[model samples]
Target: MKESFNKNDYGFWNSPFQAKDLASKSISFTDLFIDNGVVYWGESRPDEKGRNVIVSMHPDGSIQDETPPEFSVGTMVHGYGGGAFLVKENQLYFANSKDGMVYHKNLNTKEINPVTFPFEGRFADFSLDSKRKFLYCLRKNDSTQNQFPPTEIVRINLVTKETEVLFTGSDFYSNPSVSPDGKKLCWLQWNHPNMPWDNNELFVADISSENIITNSKKILNSSVGACYQPIWSPKNELFVTFDGNNYWNIYKIVNDSFEIILEKKSDFGRPMWISGTRTFSFLQEDILIVTFCDNGMWKTGKIYLKNNGFVEINNNLSTIYNIAADNNQFVMFAGNSLLALAVVSSNIKEPFKFKILRKSLDDSFPSNYISEPKEIEFTARDNKSVYAFYYPPFNPEYLKDENNLPPLIVKIHGGPTANVDCLMNPKIQYYTSRGFAYLEVNYRGSTGFGRSYREELKGKWGIKDVEDCLDAVKYLIQKNLVNKDKVILAGSSSGGYTLLSTLVKNNKFLCASCTYGIADLIAMTEHIHKFEAYYDQSLIGGSILTDKELYFNRSPINSANEIKTPIIFFHGDKDPVVNVKQTEKIATALKENNIYHEVYIFSGEGHGFKKAESIVKVLDKELKFFQKYLSN
Candidate 1:
């Protein structure tokens, strides 16, 4: 199976992975749950206008779309929605995006009915407690108050449809889990100036026999860094993930003290951007199943709590989500070595067979054309260490020219709070296969490293992110690995903003390509959604009210005149996060200054381009734009 390496000029520009091949007809799984030998998840179908529906596996092993065409089982709460549906005893409870009402569906009868009154409010991060006859959830509570929003944790009676506020006074609340006996409630709480990742508290409350919370106390505080996914064992032991020293690790509360279950540099928890995120589950309180990220590679493992030992479950699986255990078998949606996936459930015992229940994609792509990224670590301009993934250009038939260097396309990931994992991304491969050496920078402030490293760009967003990205490509050029003259910058959302920011500060790159990126920090803070309203406050050191000059100084629009290269921008007209007007303003500025730039707006797209046509067009246009500049 070994083949020869291509020796043609780098950036050869011809490969098997083309723009036309970008359309993936297969479904992508998200936020799945497993119960009683049945698995249910949301299927993101790009070909269906980016429509998302609940999908479930039948008893006969057939897969069916559970949510009808008229209903989209999604939530708008927190802007980024997940854990939108809960299943109990063959009944599905979900809040549809169309009506913002919780709907109940009988899985056996295939009949659906509205459970909550039709309203403009949104709900997410739900849990069903059949014993209390209540569905606990985190709601935005627009129907109550907004100017001083209190993160409302409400319980809806499944029978009477009456909503009662269980807890309030915290700026944010999530993951309201009820104990099996329905006598205790545990949830996550964090005030403003701190996101769930920055700092959060785990609160446990005693519930009365009448379904009332009598007393509550914070079991874990902000000194813990951040806490997530507070759940109780069958024996009523409190379990949570906490970042005590530098990494997110699991611990159990026993006799009012923390008992470390597992500790490592890896992250057992991710940022709680959306609700209902879990990285580990306690099976019967003795056997623990965990998924952790070691340098952006996700792996599932089984931990023996007694010996404090662990064994990795599957090595080839890249990304695993929605891990739940049923008896001796665990089911989860996982991406395999081929970058395609299915609902896989495997027995915990070794030598047990791994069964693929339902497949999401079956492209059967040739192995020769796929280029896997290698982890790269280098010193930044600040003399600090930085991490990124370097993907070398590859082609089975064409050889790179020894004298010509490969073009570099540096990607800046959004969230800047989030890190890019080592998963096989077709989008990056589409360019890498065609001769572009890609580098995905997990710049300062990006998570997955330790806490200090992630908060390095706390008040230095534009400065640190831009520095890390430039240093990455500079490191490549100094090492004679890539063509310095043809380097390009690309990112989406915050990454897009950094992409544009890089262009403003440096002129070495050929052009900048951004999708729905931030052009004005001031504008973004003013109009950004509720979930991220305080984002710039933390990223920019403070809000405009506190740091007016820095806000203006950090925005890309202030330095738009300094751009020395062409730029191409993409925006979805329907994007609610960063308004389309932000993109339009930048486009108008480019015209006024006579700077070379092109702007293409999609009619029905949002913050992220999800539609097949939008994705295909963006890829094609960006490719053409880069090619035009490289030739010049």
Candidate 2:
């Protein structure tokens, strides 16, 4: 048995981690919560046709699927759905993706019932008021009223099946949190031209006996910089994660004044891309467990209320999410380089150790096969520092050839606002274990570093982000870490725009792959979801009316003729974020110019690919494209 575990020479590019296996074995966990000692979470399974199932773990250490096979728990409230399910007592309420209806399931009797009818628009971020027998949530309005849908905070009577709009003037709404006593409610809202992370306000209102919202006032004003995750502690005090000082820190409202609890130059909040994002939980009246981003790496820790002292918990997790606490115990979705993303639980007294309730992927593979990322910083073209996570080639069975440098895969994360951490991502491993050095760039505009860093790409979207990617590649090549001639570029969504923009400015990469990337900034500004309706306005520094020329000049579609590298384009026809026309237009131009390229438009996919077959097909196509152009 020991001899069988020994390394063998299979060489790079012949990795056992095939794309088909990764697609089938991979699971995405989200929206975690704990109730009555039962830990529940949502799992999006690719192998099951992207069916999202609600799973539960009992104290007896038994795990079971709470969602029926006929239903998929998901929502389209923000196009990037979240907070799809919530639990109260023995009832599980979730939004079914197939018909966009909210359903209530009796956990004990296993009887499913629809609570909301179709045409009521989509809903997410649910908060149950058991005393009032009402379910509060954020709902998107039908598009019939306007091109971009408006969002509202609404409450539905659990008994009468009637929904009442609690508030409506905002362009977007999320995080409808009911107070512990169910006598008050708080939520986050922002107007157009501002993302939830860019600039949003938190408001609180007292509920009347007639269920009317009374004395509704903005608790945390918009000027306080983007506020997120308005959660009430067990003591019923209103709290939020504020970024007023550039770093997201936990702040509690004490007599109309914001008091920072455990002040640190780290982000205790994340961008509200999806609904129901929780980063901190009160384990007790005084001790709080928080997942914070410290220097781009995520860490879980405990904050003592007595003196605002913090102590990091020692767990085998680099990234943490959806933290929920009950008394001394807390559960969350956490993972690190050696461990796959899983539902883990730990107590306040035993923070150093945790038990994995469920894993997103099988971690039975040999530990030696894992390639841990090294967080690196380098000077960019603009002379500012850029951050990235570099994963060197590692295959237990394969030995490196000192004479030759490995090909490099430089990735640009989407959301020009999003940041990538040292999590155990199978896609990154698939390339690294196959003799490829993977560089995941957390460009200037990415979150977690600080608000200033996140706002770096504002008005200079194409320039700053593209330069950072170029600088990262230059830094890696100059360090003799990767083969200069074999560097490849890849990105999706906004990252894809960066990839395309980078290709236009330089001819460094041998080839590139872009998935659902924006090609025409002007077109995108004219047609996109309300969540990002004004996203390009901030990115371009002005609206289309004021910056038409900048939009045209910065858009990669207009400069498609300048790109000399062979690129493959992948897009979803049903993408609500970046229109499929974005990719199709660029491909048409490339074909017209006789540039070597391939285009694949997956059916029934949104901004991101979810179906296992689609993911497998895309990965296979990408690997084949890279191998065809990779030079030794």
RMSD of each: 2.7, 2.9
Instruction: Supply candidate 1's per-residue lDDT for 161.
Output: 88
Error of 1 at 500 (Å): 1.6
lDDT per residue for candidate 2 within 92-175, as digits (tens), equals: 999888887889989889888988766647888899988888999988878467777778898888887888888898888888
Instruction: Tell me the spans in candidate 1 whose CA falls farther than 4 Å from its real position.
Output: 1-21, 24-26, 58-60, 144-150, 340-342, 351-365
lDDT by residue (208-260, candidate 1, tens digit) is 98787877887744355888788787677788888877888888887656677
Among all candidates shown, the one with the greatest lDDT: 2
Q: Quantify all predictions' global Cα lDDT against the true fold.
A: 0.79, 0.85
Candidate 1: 10-residue stretch with minimal lDDT:
1-10
lDDT, candidate 1, residue 172? 82
The estimated TM-scores of all candidates read 0.94, 0.96
TM-score of 1: 0.94
